[model samples]
Target: MPSVRRALISVSDKTGLIELAQGLTALNIPILATSGTARFLASQGIPFTEVSEYTGFPEILQGRVKTLHPYLHGGILAPRDAESEAELRKYGIAPIDLVVVNLYPFVETIAHPEVSLAEAIEQIDIGGVALLRAAAKNFASVTVLTDPADYAMVLQQLQDRGEVGEETRLRLAQKAFAYTAFYDIHIASYLHSQHAPGTFPDPLLLAFSQMQSLRYGENPHQRAALYRSPLPPAPAIVNARQLHGKELSFNNIFDLDAARALLQEFPERPTAVVIKHTNPCGVAQGETLCAAYCRARDTDPMSAFGGIVGVNRPVDLETAQEMGAMFLEAILAPDFTPEALHLLRKKRNLRLLTLPLEQQPTTSPWELRHISGGVLLQESDGPGVDPSSWRVVSARQPTAAEMEALLFAWKVVKHVKSNAIVLAHAGQTIGIGAGQMSRVDAVQIACMKAVLPTAGAVMASDAFFPFRDSIDRAAEAGVRAVIQPGGSRRDAEVIEAADAHGMAMVFTGRRHFKH
Candidate 1:
């Protein structure tokens, strides 16, 4: 049998500690505990030696100086080897073969609104980190327990193998490192925010929690995982726990996040957006939500197959019937009426998500993206473009009716994937081309996808066209007007092309790239 001799137990939370201590004692492992833990063990009729007794000194400095001694750390960290054993015997040190420790209640203390700054600062632990690092360093011979959920697994391993395995020790060590990193990030962010309120820091503090393991990435063979920001009171997409469905693919979660983010932009109005892949296929607004669904669906019925739909109003029976006739992978709305709920229940595979409508803050502090072993952070695009800020650089300006269509198309174009071209007539999207490699190619594709020939439609480009080729192509497709953020050196050439075709043009001086 592997020698199970010494164990160190220290904890802020007392739940299940006595029971675990009793189990360890029954197995002939000596439990060395701190002051409070020792008292609890004695009260429970479970025997344990005080940590101060083992270290040959009483705890000082208001019990904060107990576990910082070299004797405790050396026993936990010393490798099990002949040379080390000889040194340990010369110093009369007994190896700490097991360590059970949990950090102070920093998260819990800060969670309470009434906690003062002094109390919160005191909750930042010192001894717990030392104990964790020591135990992790000697993980080859010691089992370090941190989370309460690991109790059963450790007990089972001790019961089955008579000792913890090396593989399990390494895995636990990795978890310990991750845990410490997360804790340090929280502290650093809190202190930095308190010190610097408004100014942007050189490096941002971004933290994430694993949400799920996906079936695959964008393709079938690539591995993928989903992570959400560790903000208190989760956002809609992050808080939405999947109750039922096949495992979500990475692309599925991306589209879902896009749909939710856009809908959060408009909470008071009845609107509908149809998205395929990562681009908007159709979008419409109406007084009655069912009317909006009708207009949005008719925008591009052919491309709506297997797409995702998001609505800003409660779903009604009439709208549900229209949705049920078509094939859709998912639908999200503020709520669902009883009849609508009954109708949607027939489509067993369709994922229905209902979130209570709440107004989103108009500003965002930061946005983040994952890179290999690092991350990129920047500010998120907060509000929609205001047409009053636009400048008319073209010789001929857009009429009031065309200006309305241009602004409407501009908002929808922002959510479409890069290399985006959208054609709008009146208030509805007539054509959308996205994710192509060239601007002119996107224009041709979008015009070809138009339900009508686009004789009177206005086109919105997400970014400035590098050349005038895209404007010429749009003119050939019978586009009546054009709207793009004007920053290109060849802007005059593109404006001339629109003027040559007797079309109206406006420049918003704002770019909306969704890459």
Candidate 2:
């Protein structure tokens, strides 16, 4: 146990301050506080010496320089060794045995969309951070606390054992450092985002807050947690409300993201997407949610077993009743009607997420993937394909109706994994082949899985066919038109194959390769 003879306390959020101060006073320890905290303590009838009085130096710069004096830092940072004691005696500075400091609300300040840079910078909290660092570095003689929630535990320990233990002190010191580190990260991220929006700096700083601990990762042996951006709430899966569900597993969240990404692409009409293993299995658009969901579900009901579903429109009773007939792992939509909610709630373990359909994620944010020794950072994949940029590469031009189906398949293929192929007719997917090692294999699998006639249907590929074999296979399956990003080694041969089959093909300059 370590004795706390003198305690310094200063906090912007003063929850439970009076009780902690009372506990410390009962233990016969004096209190030191800053001007604002001192005023608060005085109003509560808890006596405390002002930090200025203890330092013998008046605060300047409109209180920005408060508690930054050497007398304060020296008291907190000095070691308990003989040399430190001698130096403290020479300076007539007493050692501070405890420090309670929480940084100003920089995260909360920037959450306001209208907040200015000056206001956010003002909340960076220089003196409070310095005080916390000094106290934490000398934990051998001091107890540091950054969260008011810990006050009750520390108060109980002080009353029962007469002092805080070394173990508790060590934990508190670690927490204090983490608090300041996250605060500085938020400040740096905000300033950079304001000045250099999309440019990556030499040393990138990421600000994240842990939302919850997951049950496990993809495997039982691995542990994982979910973290989200420190910025204000946006239209995101992270900000979605889980209305009814068992806790989301890592796999469930991944598939939900895939489904929602496709749902955003066709928000003008009711859209439905079914995803499995982070790859879209089926997709469709209709005037009603029930019609869209049934068409999407009918594409590959076998593959959609226990899959995640995303819809761009509110779910009514008819849609909910149709969805309830399937064994789905989760459903995400903008809203659910009362009848829909009541019917769906019967499936107690179903995961239902609600996110508004109107909020488009137009701004690209930093995306990261963890490696063994380092991390890889990249911007999100580019925006929707421009219709004017697509060129007719085959001799036979795609009919107006074929163009509509081709574009619809093109949008759906972007959400599938690499080496992906989608077959669509009438704005709904007929079959999909994803995550194949070869493009020809994906084409074959997609044609094999089609329950409806492939004749007059359109085909979309994530990337161009490397050889003419994929185009030959698509033509044999009666694919009337093809859409792909044309940059293959044998582009002329592939176009010749399409022309030989009297098929129309369009080339998008950009490729959407989702790993």
Candidate 3:
């Protein structure tokens, strides 16, 4: 292949544009740019020929027709063979040895809170993606770069070898295809989302970008990698900034997700959740974050050890100092005061993350779980309870405070694993039993886990009781109220047991089995 003699450059994220242009110029490679890119190069005092000037055709249709001319593409896409050379020579086309073009930020454009369809459509680059694909197709002869992060390596290769190697070209070509494919997927998905509303198409196009690679999956022998959608699904931990700490491990991510999901349940209040093995062992909402943390931690101090903690409120010095008392694995909150960050950073291995709680979306994206042969896809169980929809099934109705505790417990149970039971009082979980095989066993475990008095606390079951035994056990354990989705064969018997104990019971008609 011919050495790189000329290069085309256009990029929406102009991160390394000037440096790349300078390097190319130093290598005596002339740069061809268009519109904003040309202006940017000129402003940076880098010599570049505008594509319109090179093609002898003025940019039309608001800069959309700049690089579509054969003058530009033919130079980049032509083969290195004699026939291609003859065609290039006949057309007086200078062979473009490199094409560095990142398409317009369609994903970023649509990410705007108020971005209109017209605005989003306008950001789509017709020529940019075409140029990337054309250069990638002729990777045997030309190099294609769709990421600015590749600029340093590409320039180093050019500077060292006077040209990019075929191997490197092949790698860049593969990346370029992936780059354009993800871009197109986002565009198509966005357009369809606007046109079709709630409907998912026959072939669902899910676009994901790697956030990071995990050390392992659930166990050290398993492999795992983390990827995220193009757009952050509001109140996302993926978008959170790690202020200080060790890298988030697979277990950390799982536990943090569980804690954050529960934290979102009490958005307006100062909420704290302690999660271990992807199950909330303690959760509480208080007037202050420190108080919430204390209440949550106090619920099951043993389980809180080395567990991930999540708080909906910004962490202050007091809270951080309080947290410093325990050997915690990680803590996630909206923000932390400088003093708090300083205090927390002392624990070198602790992971500290910041999330914006107010930005959580009311509706959620799909939840996907993989099995041996297929994926289980379902909507997230985040749309919370409507108290008015809850039917009081027992002889006694819940008081105002019990109703609050019952709703709070109900929210907490949704995040627990199947056969779950949570006992909460005054918006805090006193005990929790999750992933048990039997409802009665779950109730017994939950009662056993309670460090505080279970008396007058509300019990929340993810599903209806299979028998009256669980209800009777809850009553024996001093649970005054119960919240569960009633749809069992013996629901009437369970209600009768609650009535027998003068305990208030609510039927939600909606189950939260998370197995």
Candidate 4:
């Protein structure tokens, strides 16, 4: 590869522009820059030929037509072969060895709630994208850079080798393509969201940036990676900061997400949930963080072993000390006290992640699941059922204490898998049966799994009973009240069974099937 002789520099974000341009100039590499970039270079006392001057045509259309000329792109797109070199010389087009450009801030501009469509369109970036694509396409002869972070490395390489390596050029080309793709996706998403609200587009464009490569997927044999949406960071598992311990595994991320989702259901108080295989083994709310964690863990201590724990409140010293007693895989929390971090760091293998509690969205607008040949998209099942909308379908209405427990169980059952059954008393779960095939089996499993006494416990089911057998089973297990979305064909028989057992049954009129 020939040494870098000439470069084109234009960027909206001037993060490392000066240093890059200065380094190139020190190496006797001339620069061709747009009007705005030329002004910056002039201020820095760096010599550069303006793009219009190089092309011998004045910039038209409010500076938008400056770098769109053939002189610029012809140089960037020309190959180093004899025929291409002759054509470039015939047009007086010098070969551009480097193209450093970052597109306009379209993503940042549209993020403002008051940004107008015209304003967003103005920031769409035409010339910059074209320059990057042209250079990336001719990467065999040209080097392209879209990220400022690459400036120092590229400069170092140029200083050391007199030109960028082929491998580095290919990598930069890949990054440049990805940058343009991400930019286009954001623009299309914004326009579609504005013009075709509440409707899915024919061609769905999704963009994600890799956050990390996991050691393995669900099984050790499968490969996996973690990617996050291109939008601004939010308080979420993907945005969480890892404060301690080993790298998070694929299953650890799944269980942590489940734990976080369950904690979101009870944000009004300090709540804790223990998750295993993306299902809650235990969940509870208490006056203190420690109490909540202890209650949630004790709900099913056997299943809580090495499970992920999520807390709504910041982890305190007492809570961390309590957690130290168990061999937990990971812990997710809003924050952690300094003392707590010191104490928890003792468990060197436990993953600790923290996401702030402020401004967390109650539910995401959409959830996506991948299938064999297609993808499934739907609205998230959240914001929960309103207690005022619940109807008393049984002869008896739940008392105040029973209603509290029933509501708690209802909140928990929504997070459980389909055919889910949860038994609760006070503010803590007593037993939970999830992902069962039969509703009656879920009830029976809930009873059999109970470490705490099931007597006086209230029951909550993810969906209505298909028959009266589930109600009879719950009644026999000493459940005093039940909450479920009653839309079954056998609703009458189920209600009759609840009435016969003197159990207060409330119909939420909304089902939460988490399959």
| Every model's TM-score | 0.83, 0.94, 0.95, 0.96
What tens digits encode model 2's per-residue C-alpha lDDT throughout 1-515? 56787899989999989999998988889999999999999999998899999888988998899998878888899988899989998998888989999888999889887999899888889999999999999887899989999999988988898788898999999998888988988888788889988888658776677899999998889999998876633457887899998999888888887777787778578889989898877899887889999999888889988999999888999999999998899999999999999999999999989988657655346667899987889887743668999999999999999999999999999888888999999989988988899999999999998877888899999999989898888888889999999998899999999999999999998898888
Q: Which stretches of model 3 miss by more than 4 angstroms? A: 358-363
Among these predicted structures, which one has the highest lDDT?
A: 4
Better of 3 and 4 by lDDT: 4
Predicted structure 2, TM vs. truth: 0.94
In order, candidate lDDTs are 0.80, 0.88, 0.89, 0.90
Model 4 Cα lDDT, one tens digit per residue, 36-91: 89999999999999988899999898867768889988888887989998999998
Candidates ranked by lDDT, best first? 4, 3, 2, 1
lDDT of 3 at 250: 86
Candidate 4 least-lDDT 10 residues = 357-366
Q: List all candidate RMSDs to the true structure.
A: 3.9, 2.2, 2.0, 1.8
Model 1 lDDT per residue over 174-282, tens place: 7777777777777777667568855566566666778778788999899989886555442456665443345566877777767776666556568888878867888
Q: Backbone clash tally for model 2?
A: 0
**lDDT score for residue 166 of model 3:** 86
Tell me which of candidates 1 and 4 scores higher on TM-score. 4
Clashing pairs in 4: none
Cα shift from native, residue 9, model 3 (Å): 2.0
